[model samples]
Structure formats: C-alpha cells, structure tokens
Target: MNKEGLYRDLSTVKQQIGLAKQFLESLNSVKFDRKNVLSWFKKLCGYLTDIILTILEIRSILENHVLNKKTMLLYLYQINTTLSLYINTFVAECEIGEALNEVRIFTTKKLSSCLDGIEDVLIKGISTYPENVGNFILWMDTALEKMSEIDHLKEKEKCLKAFSDAKILFEEVLSHAMSIAQVSMSEDYKIIRGSSQSVLEGLESLSNEISKENPNSAMVKLFAETCSNKLCALERKVNVAVLKICLSTFAKYTDDLENIHKFCFNTENKSKPRDLDNLVMEFDLHVDRIMQIGLFAISCSTNMATCIKIRSCLASLEALESELVPAFNAVLLDYCKQNCNLASILKNHWLNEAVLLKRLICEIIDPLAFCQIVHEENKYLVHTLSLDVKANKSKIDRSVTEQVIRNSIVLDDFLKLITYEEDNIIHIKENISFLQKIIREVKAASDVFLPQEQPELNFKVYKRCKILLNGIYSLCKNFLVENSENSFSKEESLGNEQPVVTGNGFLDHIINRGKQILQDRSILYRSNKIEAFDLRSTTLSKMNALKEKNKSIPLSKLVHLRKISFVQSPTRNQISCELQITDIVNELRNMSLTFEKC
Candidate 1:
C-alpha cells in the first residue's frame, strides 16, 4: 500500500479505538451486561495493538533506506506510545464504570422495593414505617447524585425516571399515612371509628413492624415520634371539646353586660333607677349561670391544655362581675350626680346655658354614648370625638359661611396688591406664601371633615383656596414673564452702542445691570416658595415651553427647578439669557470705531 493508504488505515483504527473507549466509559448500570461489554473492550484493545505493531513494521521498512528515517522512526514511536496510553486509560475507566454501575443497580433496586412496600401499607391504611421511609428518601437523594455523575445520558435518564417515580410514590404514602392519622383523631372520629377501627389496628401493626426492623434508623425514629405527637394532640383536642360547652353561656353573659352598659351610659335609653336595678338583677343571674357552667367545665377538664382554656374563660366572667359591672354602675352614679336636672335643662330651651347643653348633647354626649354601645376601643377615639364635634352640621355651616366671608375679604386685599405698573415679584411672593398657608389650612381641615357624612363644608373651603391660589400664581407668572421681556429689550438696546474694546465703559455698566436683573429673576424663579407658584396654569405653560426649547438638557439644569430639594439658583433660561447678554456686550465692545476729526 502507498503512504496515503497506510495513513487512512491508521486514522480508521484510531477512530475505532476512540469509539470503544467511549462505550466503556459511559456504562452507568450493571443491567447493561458488563461481562459482554468487557469482552468487547478487550477485543478492541487487542485489535488496536495489532494495528500499532503493523504501522511500526511499515515505518521500519521505510526508514531502512530513506534519508528521512529519523523522522519516520519518531512518528512510529509516537503512535505506539499514544496507543499504549489509550489502552491503559480505557482499562482503568472500564473498572470505575463497572463499580459505579453496580452501585447504581443496587441503589435503584433497594429504593424500588422500599417504595412498593410503602405503597402497600398506604393502600391498607396502615401506619407507615418512618425508619424505612426516611432511609428510602436518603437513598433516593444519593441515587440522584450518582445518576448525575453517570456519563451515559440515556441510562442516566432511565434510572433517574425510575428513582423519581419511586420518590413520588413514597411521598404519596407519607401523605396518606398523615391523612389517616388525622382522620382517626378528628372530632368526627367517634362516628368514623366503627368503620375505620380495623384500619387503625393495621396502622398500629405497621408501626410495630417498623420498630422491630429499623429501630436504628434516625429517620424512622423521627417519623414514629411525629405520629406519637399527633396522637397526643388529638387527645388534647377531645378533652378541650368537653370543656367548650360553657362558651355559649359565657357569650350570653357578655351580651347581658353589654345591655346593662348601654342602659347605664346610653342617653337615648329610659335610664330609670328601677330599670337599672332590674337590669343589674338580670345581669347577676346570667353571671351566676356562667359561674355554674365554668365550674362544671373546670371539673370535667382532664388535661392541662383543656384546663387552661376553661380557666381563661372563667376568669373573663369573673372580671366582668367584679370589675366591668361595678365600673358601669359607677359611671351611672356619676352621670346622675352631674346631670340630675338634665330633663329640666332639656325642657327649658330659652336659657342660654340650655343652648350649650344642647350642643354638648348633640355633639359630645350622643357620639360618646354611640361609641360605648358599639364597643369601639380605638386609641384615636378622643381625637375622633373632637373632630366629630367640630364637624357637626350646625357648626360646619356657621364656620363655612364665616370662612367664605373671611376668604373673600383676604382675597380682595391680595388683589389690591397686584398692579402692572412695576414688577410686583416681592408682593406676589408674599401673596403666594399667604395663599399656600390658606391652602394648607384648608387641606388640614378637609382631612377631618371630608370623611364625615357631610363633606360640603371642607370641600367648599378647599375649592375656594385652590381658586384663589391659582389666580395669584397666574398673576405672579405674568408679572415675571413681562419683566423678563423688558430686560431682554433693554439688553437689545444696549447692544447697538459704539465699541469700547478694553475698559468697563457705558455699555459694560448696562450689561452688568442686565446681568444683575437676570440673576435676581433667576433667584426668584428657583425659590422654594415658588414651587407652589409652579402649580399655576400659566407658570406650568411657560415651564413646558422652556422645557421644549432645551430638550437636550436636563429640566433641572435648564429650568433651575428643584425636583426633590428646594434651593434658589439660576434656571436654564436665565443662564441662556445671561450668556446672550454677555455675547452682545462682547460684540458691541469689539465693533470697529468710526471717528472724525472731532
């Protein structure tokens, strides 16, 4: 054969050896018949060795007479070394693969059988052996790790699917066991026991079997402990149920206390002493009944958990009797002492004190009685009471009429401050401050009045303040716009002057004044007090126009508007105008002089 034919043969042999080595390394389970695989690998190694020997013989023949014998011999030696190394590595990998395959097979078989056994117990409604179940979970986790290590994708996928199915089955068995235990100990267990007794017996037998077979397994012990705890909880629940019979009686006593409380404190109720005495007697009877039931429940309680609950219920009843009832009586006595002539006061409507009493009745006394009857215990109850009194319909109406009149007077005074004769920036700022204060007061008042049944009072004030504030803000914006235009015109007029190249001359003085005006307006524009001014329609329109002209720059830098912080600085428009004025001044100073003999 020619050299090319020999090279092709060597290449084919190398490819075959690579394929055989890959097959040996990829084995993941003994189920693949490791004996036959080993036999095939041995044959492949023998064939590769034979091919290497043939190539060495050919190289020797070529080297015997060739001028390039040294290179040829070197190539043959490299081929021999490579084939030898590949064979050694392939053998070692095959051994490791075989061991891993054995482990995989063993783990998969054990986990499968464990899952099947668990499923059978679950079907029988028997208690699961926690030791076996826990061991199965640990084994499944290890199997997954081993499967991930396996080189053969198909074999790994197969084993992973089987193990995953087994894991799912095991989980289902655990869930079934918990459900059975829960049902056996539930409140309906008495009726269900006749049909489920055999199931519970089977579960007990399964638990015993697990204890005997896997007593050393930590997972199994934990499972058994959990089941025992659940059973104990069920017993406690049953005992507590026996003590819960008095809850309805206790609830009735709370209702009786509530009625007596209303009778004593509620102004609308006909609170005669005879009626109060009768209610007290009725409440005492309910209290005695509650005590009777509480004693019986306490005696019947068989566990600490049940006793604690029963004792808490009885204590609440005792508190109502000793503390709550007497407190209501004391409140009634106080009311009687203070308002002994309440009926006479209500009858005499012409007395000046009677009007104050009427206001107190409608505002404070009625709402307080309502809150007490409804058992409202809000911490803000006092604040709510003050708000409710202030927002009374009569008071709200009177306040609204007075506020409208007062706001009109204030607005008239503010309007008089506005004039087109000169820049009213300072007065406009003051008006803005006053308007903001008024708006803030209106907002605060609205917070209290808006949620009331009648919100017209607050709504009217808010609307009035909003309109006045917007009007003042518009006037301020117009004044600033006209002022800025006037400054721009003055700069234009000064730009036509004769050149003064070096010194600060007449044109320079005018430029400095224009710059100062720009600076002053910029200060006013970015003022924190002006943020409220920005809320006006005209100011927002002007800002939006300026924003469009300087879209490439940030609005904050261009407009000198503070987004989050409030500090005065030059706005973008002011900076741009200042730059223009400086440019005009520089141009006028650089103009060529036209001088005559004068």
Candidate 2:
C-alpha cells in the first residue's frame, strides 16, 4: 500500500482509539444494577473490540516501509499503554452485580488476554522497524521500569478507599451514639460512650497502620472487620437506648392521659358548661403534651408513615384548636340567639360533637397508653384512626354539612345583630369579632378538608367587612379622643361617634392616630400633578414626536427614557430690562466706533 493509504488507515486507527477512550471514560460513570448490567458488559466488549481493531490496523500499517516507522510506532505505542491503563483502572474500581458473576468472570478473562495480545503484537512489530530498533527497545524498557510504580500507586489507592469507607462507618456510629448520649447520659449510656471512644481510638490506630510503607492486607482486613463489628455494636446500643427512653416517656404520659380520660369522660358528675370548659382546657393542655411526646417519638421513629401521620394528626389538632373551636363557639352564640338558651345550645350542638372528637383523640392516645407494646404491633394507632374516621365519615360529614348549612342562617343573624345594634359600638365590635371567627373557621375548614372544592370568600364581602370594622374603630377613636366636651361635634355627629372612654394615654394616642389617618382628606388630592403623567404616556409622546420629525424612522430606533423626565427652570427671567453697567458701557463703545468708521 502507498504512504497516503497507510496514513489514511493510521488516521482511522487514531479515531477508533479516541472512541475507545471515550467509551472507557463512560465506563467510569456506569452504575451497575440488574437492569443495566448486561448493557454495561456490552459496552465493555465494544471498547475491547475497538482496541483490538485499532491495534490490528496499526500493525498492518507498520508493515509498509513508506511511512516513517519509528515515529508512527511511538504514537501507536501510546494508544496501547494509555488505553490499557484506563481500562485496568476502571475494571479495578468497578463493582459488578453478583448475579452476573459468571458472565463477568468469563468476559474479564477474555478482555485481559486480548489486551495482553494487543500489547505483545505492537511491541513485537516495533522491534522489526528499521534495522536498529533502539527507540522501541528503550520505550519497552521504560514501560517495564514504571510497572512497579503503577502497582504501588494502585495499592495505595485501594488502601485509601478502604480507610475512607471505614471512616464513614465510624462517623455514622459516633453520631448515633452521641444522639443517644444526648437523650440520656445515665450509667448505662456512659458504657455506650466508653465503647464508642474505644472504637474511635481503634479507628485512629488502623488509619496509622494503613499509612505504613508495606501494610499487611490481612491485618488491615481483620482490623476493618473488627471496626465494622464495633460500629454495629454501637448502633445496636444506640437503638436500644432510644427505645428505652421512648418507652419510659410514653409510660409516664400514659398515666396522665388515663387520668385525663377519667376526669373528662368517665366522671361521676353530670357534664355541665363549667365542666365542659374545664374539659376543653384540659384537652388542650394534654394535646400539647401528646404533641411534645409524639415529636420525640417521631424523631426516633424509623417508619416514614408513622412520622408523617403523627405530624399530620398534631397539625390537624392544632388547626382544630385555633380554627374550629372558635367557629364552634360562634355557632353556639348564634344558636343561643335563636333558642335563647345557652344550656340547650351546649347540650344539643356541643355535647355530642365534643364527645365524638374526644373519641377520636382517645384513639391516638389509647395506643400510646400501651407503652409496653412493640412499635410494629402498636403501629395500628394511625391505621385504626383512619379506619374509624372512614367508618364515621358519614357522621362527620353530616356534622360538617350541618355547620355549612348554618352559614345563611348565621349570616342572617349577623345582619340583624349589626342592623339592630349598629349604633352600639360594643355590640358592633362583638358582632364583627363573631363574624371574623365564622369566616376564619370556614376558611380554615376549607383549607384542611377540601381546598379545591370549597369556594373562597368573595372579595367584596371581605372588603365590606374590613370597611365596617374600620368605621367602628374610627367612631370609637373620634368619640374617645377628638370630640370636645367629649360631646358630638359636626364631624363627630356626622360620623355618629359612640361614647368611648379610653383611660390609657397610649391607647388614646394610637386611636387618635388611627382616626386621623382614616379621616385624612389629603389622600383625595394628588401631591404632585406632574407625577400623574406616568412613564408610559411620556415615552409614547416622545416616540410620536420622533416619528413625526422623521417618518422613515422606526419606533424601536428612538431613544428610550428609563424614567419620566420633569423639566424645571427659573420661574422669573434672569435677564434684566434695565441694562447692567458693563452692558451699557459696551453698547456706547460700539456706537462711537461705528459713527467714527462712517
């Protein structure tokens, strides 16, 4: 073959080598799993095939005497050495799936033999180039000299990797032990701490040994296993300690919960309003306690579902306390307006519903009362709550439906209360608070239950509610702070000020400020008339002016103003009608010079 054909073949070989290097680099990123293991092995075979083909082409090109064989061999020598190094490093680091162990073993053996054969062919062929093969011999000697150094480097890398993995395990163990120690530094826990300290000391010693010139692999393996065992022991101790703490805490609260249950429900006394109030207060306090305990339990909990459900239940209860309770209170007040009996409202609406809620609360608390039960067995708390709630969903839905149905009736009562007692500031305040509570409950329930389905409160209603509230506040402030004689003035009478006695100076100041702000008439007038012309109009005007001046120019070509420009100049002209002395002298000089020239 001619030199040109040989050069072309050599370029093809170089391209193949480049592709093979890329595939080798890609192997570095390959994650071996059951699904991709076959494909991963396939890529490996392809890379080997590329290397083999490139070596064969180079060998064939070397047979031609036309090309300068020494330089070409040097370049070709690099292809084998560099790719061989890369493939070897990748194979050393890769962890193939065990299920493909047979396939991997067979494939790896074949690949290794192929690489050896390719290297041998290249070296043997180079020895024949030009009569004196000094370059090829020298290169072969240098490569042989570096083989030991490369092996040493590989060993060091393996040792470093092993040490790193051991260090990670050590950190995990220490962190877990520290968490347990934080929970309780009792004598038993101190034993765990001591064990952890010993493990850490052993780890440091192992690291020092690994850093030695010729460390024993067997000794390193044994020490690593020992450290691993210690870590496992430390982990087991931490788990046990956490379990013990959780048990003791749950036990302590279990008795308190039972006592509360007895006081609230299983009491001998007939349920009264005062009793219900006390029960509600106790319920809130205990729920807070349960929440604290649940938080601790969740931190220790390994189960994702348990953590999620406990967090969710606590969140729901908190929402109920902040939102639903007040709504129910307002509902009670509204119901009292109709029945004219507080006792009947409490019994009819509050009693049964409170009982049902308490029942649901008990479902969560009851499981925790059995603190002796294992976590797996006791995990039925959330499940039971779900099942029970689902079973009682119709009843719960009926309760929610009943509450929703009263919206119109409650709104009617709200209108009547506001209209009937509109002049009464105290009554208006109370009614507004009640209305706000109702809206809050509705919105809260909507958020908690079915946010997508529940329609939002109309914007107009919200605005009007705010207006009514503001008007009431203004009247109160004006009556308290502004009215002279504390009697009605023109503005006060026009505002229909109520009789408000604010003994607090701070309160009077605040209210007076609020009233002034609300009644501030300057807001009706613009401070700067020029500001009324915004940047949009000014830019448009400028663009129109530019267009009229040059019809050929596009709007985009016109300069853009970042902000509106307001031009200011002297109000009175600075030029005087009565000339200055300098000006008069110059004019006289000019007149004399002109007449003389004529």
On TM-score, the candidate that comes out on top is 2
Model 1, runs deviating above 4 Å: 1-253, 268-271, 336-598
lDDT of 1 by residue, 1-598 (tens): 6877666655654554455444444434323234544454344345434434443433433333322332222222222322222233233335444232322232233223322332232223232211111121222222233222222222434434433333333222222222222222233223222222322333344245343533333433344334333332332322222222122232242456567766767655544777888887876655444433333332322222222233333332332233344545555666652232221111121122212222221221111111111111111222343464456542333343233334433333324432322455566557556655664565565556545646466445445544543544343343343333222111121111121133324323323432332222211002222222212233234334434766332111111011111122223112222232233233322221110000
Number of clashes found in candidate 2: 0
lDDT of 2 by residue, 1-598 (tens): 6778766765665565456544544543455443343355445445544544554444444445322333233223322322332232223334322232222232233334334333433443432122211111111112222221222333877667546543543443353344344444264346556556656665776677678898776666666556645554544454444434433333333343333333433324334346546655655544444443444343332332323344433333332343333433433334422222222222222233323333332222212111212221222222332343445432223233223323322332323322222355575457446545644654454345442332232222223333333333333332232332223221221111122232444333333432332222111011222322242244334335434765342111111110011112232213221222223234334433332232
lDDT of 1: 0.33
Given candidate 2, what's the lDDT at residue 115?
40
True lDDT of residue 573, candidate 1: 17
lDDT for predicted candidate 2 compared with the true structure: 0.36
